[model samples]
Target: MAVKGLNRPVIPFMAYLLAAILLAMTPAICLIPLVDSVEVWQGLEANTRDLRAQTESGILLSMGLVDTGLKLFDNTLNHEMEEAFGPVVAEYERAEGNPGAMDLSRVREELDGRMEIYIINESGVIEYTTYLPELGYDFREIPYFYDRITEIRLGGFFSADRVVAGIPTGEFRKYAYLPSPDHRYLLELGLAPSEFHESRMALKYGDAVRELVNLNPEILKIRIFDCLGTRIVGEECPDDDRRLSLVRQAYRERTTLEVENATARELTRYLFVDLSDNDYASDMSMVVELTYTTKAAEEKVAGMFARQGGVLLFGFALIGCLCAVAMHSLIRPVRNFVEDVDLIASGDLDHPVRVGGSEELVHLGESVSAMVGSLKETIQRVRASEEAIIRHSHTLEEQVRERTADLEESNRMTTLLLDIMRHDISNANNVANLYADLLATEIEEEAEAELLRRAKAGLAKSIEIARDVNTIQHIEGGLPSPGPVDLDRIIRAEIERSPGARITYTGRPVEVLADDLLSEVFTNLIGNAVKFGGPEVGITIRVEELGEEVVVSVEDDGPGIPDAVKPRLFERLSRGTYKESGTGLGLYICRMLITRYGGEIRVEDRPEGGTAIRFSLRRAGTGGEP
Candidate 1:
């Protein structure tokens, strides 16, 4: 008993140490994510600030280039005009902002359509132009464009904007403005794209976009949209009405706008860039669409996660290693003590048990070692007692065999009594039924006669119960083996037993693997349906050949079994319903017999509102039915 108790395991303390370690590390581990979050937030803020400055600086630099390039470009145009019609433009100066004093028709013939020159009066109206379309166009209706020209009419230096599409026509053109010497009218030259424009690459927006994108890693894309809401530089995407509206808003407000698009994982920045002057840069003004990514901050957070995980892994491994080294001193002695005790318990009394470590461990080893000597003597006495017990057990075995024989005799007697009781029950119910038949014949009144008939029916039901009891009692015992049996013959015979029943069967010649008792299965099922469904009930006996097995379902238009009772219908003493007659052992016996023939039976609900007892038996032969 003591040895067994020593071998029995006690509740373990494995989790305590691990819990302590986790508790100790809780603060540090919890701090990791918080620190990571702060770092990410800081990184994003710093990145946004740096890129904001960079973006504004780049815009300012581009504006400066556009401002300077206008002067050089305008001077070239003015030089060309002077060469073409130096005397003509000097002749037209006396028009006094009227532009009708000179022969402009002769100047237009000299120019030959290389460029179109516009004479804008101080009131910002185009009074004369080489192009006939602007013979006397008024720019005053357009408050923004008129304001830009007024500023140019007022400013000293000549300025031009980058090539842009027309506001309404969408035609590409570049215009530079200069003050005609007397400032009476502003001389404006509109230049279409030609070989001369290729030399003026200083104001190309495409170059600026490409440069910014190439220099900044966070800049995924850059697009410049002109005042007409057309993407002039960078890649072109499909027109987004929302985005175009936002661009128009930026142009109106002349302020920067930012939209963080989570689905695209980028921040869209709209920088309303003003060229030359805020009000005067109407055609030159544009919105810079900057798409920025924060890949650096995301990578920083991911890197921190990986590094922290590695550090935690290393810390855990170090703890494990230190624990293993420390446990060796205590574990070795305990392990040796357990092993030696186990060995002694397994009949190896001579096995040594020595533990050297702490004073308590030494004392335990000494005490156990002394116990082992006493155990050795005790084991000898136990061995002697065991030998005597073996001899006594042999005698007990003989007595057990005699008791077993008596038990078998008792079982046989019980079975005999069951047979006698079944016979007596059958005989007694048959006599009662005979008396009921006689009483039924003597009754003249119809109601009294009906009562006698019901009494006989009940007596017959009792007789069925007696036979069912006999059949069910020995269901678990041996039965006849399966053999070739006429399926139709058996079904037809069972059908004949109930002549008046509404049984439907398309008889066909078939053979199945079952003994003569297969008829009992049909009997119990058919009788059950008739007893419950009454005379008008319809019954269907169906047989289907499926591969090596033949399935048969005996269904009736009786009150269908409840779904809850279907599972246990074939179990011993499981009646269909309390109101039905006969013992519940009929279906149970059928199941046992079907099982003996290597078939299975089950209770099911027929689709046509009835209960069905379905069973399967193997085909008689390997080939088609004989």
Candidate 2:
């Protein structure tokens, strides 16, 4: 059987399988790069820490070597002075008794190699010495040698300077005077500055030590100060400007001035080591100044980081390439499935996709194939059913039309009869009531008066029925057109017309696009409230204007309609569970009239009490009320 226009072909199974595969591959591809970048960052961080540690270690080791070498040089100089001076003083003492065998020149030459040797006599006189021409005058005129000879009574030593080899130079030379057994003559040995320079030259790794450890070799300046922070040697010796500045700073602050300029750049990391002997060793109190360039250390660290980054990049690239190949292989099936689905969606479901690897995809293809077969069968079945239903529907519609025509004819006949009877009977009942009064007065018999009373009662019932019939006719004819009307006036008039009903207006004056029809609407709503509600029931008319619509609510404090009947309240001939006397067309007519004017009407249970009938009328625009 051929299906109707609604028939649709089923999608192929392979297409669905491809879609799922592609969706799964997307995240996998994204994670590949993310994971690789994280690994690279981790490696770089580790390399940075290692490089910092290595740089710090190298700096500490270099400083240690410099300090050790300085210590050795100081010790050797001190020992050499003590050894060479001891013998010279002994010879001077022994010769004091025999002036003929004194031989000062020979004594000086013998001690020359033993120390930075020079000779001074018992009177603090430079009598003979190596480099003799450089001592322009006798040592007796020199205060340092004289002071040492007088102060060191038992041949103790003092450091001083003098001419050596005809050139004036500074040295850590020791002067000692030994008294003869007769206590008449003294001898002295002075170490020249040349001896200290020679000792520095003889040290192992001397050149490398000077090159690496010299803080500022190009503008090299060295100053040594005593424990009291007073300069003892170097250029501008004993009172060099740099040394004095350091001494003054220490004196004012009362602390050691140890500054290390560890980099050539203006930025330098300096440690001010405290020289307080009260809590530490005397050797530790000696503050060493070191200066070096940070450029080298910075370069080394940068190189290490760069190398690490390069290695990481290379490794990640390799991994990424391998992953890409694997990802392509895994995702190709998904791509093919997607293309197949696209073709199916574009209305070409005839082509079947070629099945590939993976059990999941194969199962999906099978499912899709089964679904397509089922869909094709369903389409054929649906088509046949549709044709049969169409034929049956046409027959049913014809029958319904015939029945509706008959029903309308019957309704018209009934309405005509009811109208004629209501008019004729109402008139006859009025005439009968008038004649009964006359007859009752004229006859004046008890039996006749009772009969007249019965007749009058029947007349009243007939009149009531006539009124109900008239009301139904007026409503069924369609409500009158509306113009601008005061909603308050209409509500008040309805309340007055139905006096027995309790009516309350809780809103201000609200003008609406309505006329007599508004009055009719209110009349019907108010009448219903009074007729169906208890004596105590109150009717409230609420009016409000929303942006482009005016709403009016007529709420009644009455027993609400049952839930089952509420949905059908606006339907023709629908009645509530409560058997109130009504044609059941009042709400239906109300809905029709309101809808014709672009308004809505609804009935709902009141929040606190009975039932509320709400209707909204659209505000006037350039066109008539909508």
Per-residue CA lDDT of model 2 for 1-626, tens digit only, reads 11111222334546556755755565455455546655665666566446434533443454356445654565555555555555655665577555435665566667655443344446655545555653434545545435545555344434332212221443333332334444444444555456565665453322333443343322234333433344433336443466456654654454534544544442212222333322111222222222334454456556656765676677667666766776686666667666765765675656475445455655565665566667767878999999999999999999999999999999999989978987898888788878877877787788978877877766755665565466557656666565666777777777777777778886666666765665657766876786679667888888888877888889998987778887899887676676553666667667866776678999899878789999998665525554
Which RMSD does model 2 reach against the true structure? Answer: 28.6
What local lDDT score does residue 364 receive in model 2, on the 0 to 100 scale?
Answer: 62
The numbered model that scores best in TM-score is: 1
Clashes of each: 0, 5
Error of 2 at 262 (Å): 52
Instruction: Write one digit per residue (lDDT tens) for candidate 1, span 1-626.
Output: 12213333332345445555754675466567558766766877787778767866876577557656754664565445445435445656665545767666666566666556778887777777666666666777668778777777677666654454545446556666776666677777666657355666556766755665677777887887877678777776675688788888898888989998776678878888876355234556788887788666567766767777677677667767766676774477578778878987897777777554444555576677779889888988999999999999999999999999999999999889988999898889988888887777678998888888778768877887787776766564556567799999999998888898999999698888777778889888888887888888999999999889889989888888887778888888787654764677888889888888778887788776988888988898865334
**TM-scores, all models, native as reference:** 0.43, 0.31
lDDT of 2: 0.58
Clashing pairs in 2: 122-186, 131-165, 134-166, 482-515, 483-514
